[model samples]
Target: MEKIFTLAELVEEYGTEVQKESFENNGNLNRRSFDSIIKRVEQDWESVKEEGRGSKRKIKCSGKLEDKAMKKDGRVRSGRQQVEHRIPMDVIVATHLEYDMTQQASMSLGKWAVEFGLITELEYDLLRSRHSSKLRQKHIDKAIQSGTLEEDQTKLLDEFTQHCLEIYGQLVKTLEHMEKCGIILFYENWMAYGKDGKVSINPEIMKKILKARRELMKKHEVVEFNLTAHRNAKKVKNFNREWKETLAEVKDENGNKLGIKYYWKEYAVILKASSKAVQRYLETYCVDSLEVYVNDKDLFINENVADYELKRKVNIMKKAEKRHKQKLQEYKEQKISFATAEDEEWIRFFYTQQELEDIVAGYDLGVKRLHLQNLYMERMGQLFELYNIKGYNNKKHLEGVS
Candidate 1:
């Protein structure tokens, strides 16, 4: 198994070279540096003692004996393995502090960490405590100078206080950027847990988180296509024309092709005509009438009158009705003419299916553009927080007076 390096061991062995090469090599601290540090830590592991807990021996397991016992048995046995202290507590704590510092700086400056890699939970806690202590001590010494305490340690207190304040300010800015980007705080916490830590986020959970964040930022707009209505109208006109053409070829028996006259027959013709005429009439006029009736009975009845009273009324009112129908037909033709012109205008104004599809594609492109823009803004905010322009300016003013 590969040995893990404690923070102190990593720093003592590799930190200087990693930091020096990082800027020149585009901020990548190579694996070779880490490997060398790990080698050194493994060589010294037995001698290294745990911090604060005096003279305690490192834990170890007798793996050789366990392997021999397992080989002797025909059946394999399953049980918990013995725990060994592979990495020292001091190293773990130091590594975590270094990682936290690098990460905190990266978040504030919007720059990748060059020297330190990942931190552990113990290190993070230690760094936080050290920061808090320096801040509190600065305040305590200032109070003491105002006769709060007779003796006070004020040496380099102002510089340490400023450094702590700078770090805190950077941390706040980094947190804000993370929030804006929808980055969960749990990632940092998880990293702090170190390699031996078992807690982890599943890939499925991460995918869902990404999806939700994307949806929150997405903006949608509807686009419509007008082809359906136009297509239906065209279908209706084609079907009507086809029905009329089919009805025009009527014939009758007596070997004569019957015209539309054969359609007025009240009963099946006991041929006063040839079989050919009768058959032709039945096939053409009869079939045509039946088909018309099936498609639209109202049209068939309007063009073919049967009642005596209605026929007589039709003859008597024929001239008046023809004039009235002519006027109505003329009015309907004019309405149809106007409607056709309006339809052309509407076709020009509205989107076609092709155009609507293009618009939807443009919306998808906008989503990517918007996400990138937001990310850029978030990164800019992080950089501004790192520099501490306000504090730097205040310090310059105080120095000019001195």
Candidate 2:
């Protein structure tokens, strides 16, 4: 099939020649003349191509240009880094606060040494004896100075400390940003248990807090969208329940079952969807909205029928998305470990998903221990949706279901 070049490409190739000719023949560039030109290209595609398909066509813009937004604020948002540290929670909250860090109890050296493999178990015991309880970063430094830890290990400790400082800085900046908005820490209830366990405030208190916050949320418009809009209907599979074999009704050889999937007659509508419907429906209108006039000899799918440049960009993005999903799947199945290449982008992406999923799942389990470690953070969970709606999330005026 011959390529139908866009107006921009033709203008670029023939320069003023095509534009002048098109202008003269069409009488000052009316829609009728432009349409005739496009129609002519459609009609004589083979003839034009057969004469000089020799030269490769470099496509140019086919439509209006877009403006890019740039931030005037000095705040720089860095890409996520693959570093974490065991900064004392108090120091993290109080770095800008006046304090002699040396006076504070250092983190346990035995734990740090064991986690980082900086020293042997016997070496850790010796160091712990010398420094007393709660081994600190200084203790690790002393160990390295005294020939207990290798020089490379000393470098690792320094990196850990630096990473901690960087994280603390980012945290402070984020808090500042939040404070600029209406969010604030107020009347926090905190408690703690053994390591690694986290839970919300007691259910009784949480119920009251959530009720109050939800009432506040009602003061604004509750933007809505099809939450499952991202799900591709074609790709959805039937749910496979383990108990189906036992509980499902018996089927005959013809595959007829005693039971079928059920649907309710009255579907409760949640959307303020009329405007959104128009916006989304417009996408599919031009696609197969009208029949193509073509000979029986040649027919093909027009899946990538947009502007050539746009089609190319879409293809590039699809390839990138495929690679990202492959990496994520590999990470999920334990094929890709983030330990060695923590800063690598795919590693950070995988770890972020893993960490967030873990935090969510962990929050779902056990009782509400009411262990609110960070005062500023406690009420943030309640404000999650509010942030997204109030433009703090940086996505505003969405046509896609909010």
Candidate 3:
């Protein structure tokens, strides 16, 4: 059986004169200081106790890391302390399972974990602040049901959840956009190996796709939704503003001024609006107009195709026209799902022309899964730059050792 020491005996055995300086004027230990020391010792008891005569008695830390902690002035350095080593503080804390260091670091680690197959998509959702809020409210509701919370406390929590709802709704919109554009699915499919014992479907193709996805995520991580307030359209219309310069009349060679161009104001407003917002507006207001334009087949086909000078060019156009009709028939027959205008626009940003063509033709889930695994490897390389964790960043660092 192991020996157990009471709080008094442990303090008497390990507390130094310097630690005693933190005691109260009445010669009693300060609870805060004592707790701090206890926590530090719990994290690195071996290093703390090894300097004294009672060093032979070993005490284990609750954390997974068993390495001796760095010491300064005979006190164990806590996780919050700045690491003096080559690795970053965040990296060290994450490796030791001390996630409370920083939310940004923890979120980055969560993404890295998903990329490396260390965690599932469901597990990663818990790391998101939006999901965390929902989960908190869930427990709050449960507590209310169980009559565990005071009436005042319950009221406050209910009000808090209501305030969080709007922010949660915004987060859901952005996350749904991510899911629609295949970012979420990409990570989900990454955590698997193929039949050939290789992860990627095609490394060369996936490298480009992964880079595009990374750029997209980085751009949107701190996105401005402009949810609360609208742009000052009233101010833009004022004559005193610089936007008036855009409305300046066009000049002719003879110095005669043309009428003020209305297109400029339209262009300015459209340019200021987000693509999704603009698309939504157009879809709501211009659906009939778009349908009318699309149905005008005469606008698409040239009446004088036979008048072309080059036979090769004419043959190519004919083939294109034939393929168009085939695609229309395929849509009519419902053999393949047709991409919406929004989806097409989104897809153009993330895929190459050839890849988009193949996707429109048909995509195999197995092929996509393989590609995602390749993308995973590419993403892990980027994660290494974010956190300089030794072994995970470089495979060669742990090539031979188990």
Candidate 4:
């Protein structure tokens, strides 16, 4: 069995000078702040010991303890096992925010921490700003050290350019065809508005057109990709000024202009739909009939298929909304922690079926709280699709009857 140190012993051994300064007033080494940290560290240690060194559970320690352990064998020891030391905290203070930032998928742990009342908004903002700057500096140092700073920048620019090109190709054709047919495009889900005897492009294309248009408008605003601006050229005004203007002055060995600057205007002109008619046409299409194609087969040509898909989405949305509202009420009652609908959507987007199943199956080693089951069940509900709820109900009834 591993030894667990008491709060007093831990404060005596590992509390930083600043923490010790508060000792005279608080008497328990600022126990309010450190309590969660102590629990987190103990949880991590227990997880590592039970799961072994190969576990993804990060083993954290106080910097002073880690330094002492490193001196012994150039590695940190957790009880009888050697574990990798990632972040070092001095009595699990605000420094632990860095670990959360690293572990969080979206790097927005600070916001969530504040939302959960683990930290005050002021503390969250300050810590986020401070850590973000450190992360930026660290990125710069690593990029410079790898000698791939320029290469990475150019690659990113190229990828952005390609994305713009793809967007232009798709949107220009779809919008033009819609205009020719006098069809109006709506930004909302097609089934919501278009199912009532309306003709327009599907919701997917509508999203692409909107996103592509935004990217086109933002082309010049992208500072790093503005080659002329980087060179401090005199004709910066001409750069991304119009559809006719070239993007950059760079030329290849053959004197052919190079980079996104060369074809920037052309891409923008075609993609941006700058003409008032096209812009309005993008916002509103007036066509009464439309056909959707998938793999050269008309999808909506078979009304059954379109109906099936629409019905599927409607069922999904109904179930998701019901479950989400229930979870929200549960959260209000303090029976469970709840994620917002947007967060649940992200969970649906990012988590695979197997991953979600693993989480729901009590196999999520990292999160063992009682409310976690309730939370993940909500996520599973979000991902569930019931195209035939009536059929399912009948089957369930038969099974229950048996």
Better of 2 and 4 by lDDT: 4
Which portions of model 1 miss their true places by more than 4 Å?
A: 1-348, 352-354, 360-402
Candidate 3 segments exceeding 4 Å error: 1-19, 22-32, 46-232, 235-402
lDDT of 4 at 1: 31
Residue 329, candidate 3: how far off, in angstroms? 48
lDDT of 2 at 258: 26
Residue-by-residue lDDT tens digits, candidate 2, 331-392: 35543334466455765675675464444433211111211122112222222222112212
How many angstroms is residue 56 displaced in model 2 relative to the true structure, after the best TM-score fit? 54
Which candidate leads in TM-score? 4
RMSD (Å) per prediction: 45.9, 29.6, 31.1, 30.9
Residue-wise lDDT of candidate 1 within 307-342, one digit each (tens)?
Answer: 312332233234333433553444334321225887
Which candidate would rank higher by TM-score, 1 or 4? 4
Question: Can you tell me which runs of candidate 2 are displaced by over 4 Å?
Answer: 1-134, 137-152, 185-402
lDDT per model vs. reference: 0.30, 0.30, 0.33, 0.32
- Cα distance off (Å), candidate 2, residue 129: 15
Please identify model 4 stretches exceeding 4 Å from their true place. 12-18, 24-26, 47-246, 249-258, 261-402
Clashing residue pairs in all predictions, respectively, total: 14, 1, 0, 11
Error of 2 at 194 (Å): 27
- Candidate 2, clashing residue pairs? 109-135
